[model samples]
Target: MRILFFLAFFISITCHGNLIWSKTGHRVTGHIAEKHLTRKAKRAINDLLDGHSLAFASTFADEIKADRSFSKYSAWHYVNYPMDIRYEDSEKSKYGDVVMGIETCKHIISDKNSSREDKVFHLKMLIHLVGDLHQPMHAGKGDDRGGNDIQLQWFDEGTNLHRVWDSNLINSYGMTYYELGDELEESVDKKKKLEIQAGSLYDWVHESHQKAVEVYASVEVGEKLRYQYGYKYNKLLFEQLQKGGFRLAKVLNEIFS
Candidate 1:
């Protein structure tokens, strides 16, 4: 039992270091996107992934962090820009960002000259980066390293603004990805679904950047966030997840169908 406890503690500490839309959150995005995939997109994806579900494959980008060779991909997960300027107007990162990542993935996957292995690799990355793109903190200010530097407490436990937005509330809510996804997916009316799926990649990135501005204002350094913070932002969180799903489906459909 002591050995098991040690393993769990080690894992908890290791996982807390990630700056991502937690594994379950990514799975939730993948699940919702699965429900709305076009038949052609589904068929194409089945071929590419060898019958794997998007939920099963969505964590590829984050999972690769464990490997030293994947270091180049680190910057592809998030982007930084000032709140007041448009992304086009802002200075860009030399290492690449979510928008560039999405474009590269699409180009590779859609390239008939590309190899099967390359398509599979980039398709998984595309799914994950799309999910990442919606986690407002991933589109955060450069100075804060996308909220990873803003230290704070999450209900008396030590955490940062980035981790809080990444996994704190969703994990504390304690539902499996499938369970939360079913609940959020059912809440969508047809018209709302259409609206969510209507935006372009450029448009979606800016939308998330705008949300990042608000998320940054939600708390301050050394502040303790608890139930009230959850109550206030949970709705916004759900909205972003829903948008990520619908938009992912839209992106995939445009590519494969």
Candidate 2:
């Protein structure tokens, strides 16, 4: 029984992989982006989304995961690069990756000939992928499946590195997406918002990749993460979330402008 239990645990830990950010995090990104949208862009988005708010549309990509047709998009959520390499210098995935996924969605949305249904689908995908792009783990190295194989304990519960960043830290705050988004927005100044939104897509991906390196260095396998771990990384987490929101708004505004 002991051996059987251990084997099961091992399999569970090894198989664990993150689909994307927690729903709360994605909604927070969408909410923040909504706050920054230009008047024209907001009107156009409402029309395209059929009156759905950005927060409501943000999870569409993940919500479609149950459909087999979306299986091809599984790779659209992340792009892995080695610690020593830049994404432009790294090998690209053939199916699609977060970078290509975002660009493709942008292209589809920008094309006037695209049908209303196609624009809506890709725009929802673009919003969600932008949120995913800012998550450090989503930009993690290919080996270890973006740290999914690196198992640890979160206050005595078994978890892995990818899950830790994806949900554990954010959920620990106990705030709804609206509450958290409000707080993050309050903490930033005009200069800081511009700084966060200033980067090109590749630059943003590189930033997240660098952050992934810092995150990997902060914990060890089997380490128990609790208050201290959260405390150390919480500020960084909020910063990334804020940047994602502003950048997403910038992209949408530019597309609709």
Candidate 3:
């Protein structure tokens, strides 16, 4: 009961209020792209996919089957643990949840007994979780299911804190997934390439979690945001989405290679 109370209270604080929008869904999708490989990575991917044509969900299912530990959780489960804090106030904050996620992925991947498919599952999960870890809200601390409990009026409809960020923000762009991906692909180059490095999953999550902190800090209590803000942030959102996809692809390619 004590733990339940604490969890409930925390949930209210983080989510039941005004906090809205997160990058979880887009990041998850992006991670899907990140883990899909090309060329030599094919064999590893084949073992991972069990002979599927390499679509996103198929790869995800393969990874899940490989890693039994993950069965305790789900594809959308939150990452565990936190990392270094640059700000004292943020020390108690949830900004580094992504770091935890990356580490979790690493742990599963490195286990010798882990099946090829499970390694693939962990890898795919890591890719998606890394994307979630980056979303400022997923790194949320103080409960609120990362602010899912927060209620708000998004575009004149009543919504919760989590839903707005999970899908609504991207939906506002009015672009299909393919269209968004293509537009972002056009912007990619050597510079963007340097932004996402090939490293431990924990490192990637920490990077995003840190950014999540910055995002929450920028908003105010009860501030009603509209189109201008969305437009300004759209590019950033797309970039994250694209980065996740490309990085996912790169990571999977490496493992299979």
Candidate 4:
């Protein structure tokens, strides 16, 4: 009983959502998804977003964080599970998690009985959450609050492990979302695209968790990460953004097509 109580207490405190990718990372996924979307999916998105690009609509979920009424979504940005445990074998967050958020968005958007307003809202959230799912830090273990507590410095500026992965590396690379997305498109030929799009959402979560393990190993608490860290991780960074884009396209295509 004591162990069960302790576990429950730990989850209640640790599973609060962490910030996801920076605006640029989200936009890269959105841009790549746009290129790969089917004609019907594009039309549906156009109607829902009033012709805005997916990149334009990709950050709605984060933008609403300032509003108190949107507080229910605070826990929907990340999941809590043990590092070595597969997500299916771990305890689930009672408040909700990214998987639940994605499923909710899908249901609302797909239901013929759903209100147009509800569809629009959920679709926008879905776009952001899909990209959120790819940011491996968001999939990090809950004990450290998705690495937000792992304080460090980026080029001597104070930051945390989560922020470094969320924005610092991508920001330091200094490419616009368009440039990054274009490069990814050129690099991903048909076979690679197929492989990227092949996984189920569950598989993607497991994949991110694996990456998170490496991420947690990359630095000690209070470590100062500099140019060398960025150099080493840039490929992983780009791969994640690219994977996110491909998977998001697959999801939107399935939903709308």
Regarding TM-score, does 3 or 4 come out ahead? 4
lDDT of 1 by residue, 1-257 (tens): 99986776567447535568999899999999999998999999999999999999999888777565777888888999988987888888899999999999999999999999999999999999999999999988999988988999998799998898889989988999999988889999999999898868888899999999899999989999999999999999999999988888889999997
lDDT of 2 by residue, 1-257 (tens): 99986776565433433757888999999999999999999999999999998999998888777555667888999999788778999999898899999999999999999999999999999999999999999999788888888999999899989999999999998999999999998888999889889969999999999999999998999999999999899998998999899999999999999
Per-residue lDDT of 119-191 in model 4, one digit per residue for the tens?
Answer: 9999999989988888888888788988999999898799899989989999999999999999997899999
The backbone clash count of each candidate, in order, is 0, 0, 15, 0
In model 3, the worst 10-residue window by lDDT is 15-24
> Which portions of model 3 show Cα errors greater than 4 Å?
1-38, 50-55, 58-71, 74-76, 79-113, 198-202, 221-223
Please, what are the lDDT tens digits per residue for candidate 3 over residues 1-257? 99986776566434322322233344334534634456666665555656653335423422343344544434243432243453222443244334444556667776778877668666665655545544556555445565555656666776654455556678777766556655666666757665664555545555556655555554454455568657776665665666566666765555555
lDDT for predicted candidate 4 compared with the true structure: 0.88
Candidate 2 — worst ten consecutive residues by lDDT sum? Answer: 8-17
Alpha-carbon RMSD of each model: 3.3, 5.2, 7.6, 7.6
TM-score, structure 4 vs. true: 0.92
> Model 2 off-target regions past 4 Å?
1-17
Could you tell me how far off, in angstroms, the CA of residue 27 lies in candidate 1 after the best superposition? 0.3
lDDT of residue 106 for candidate 3: 67
Angstrom error at residue 70, model 1: 1.1
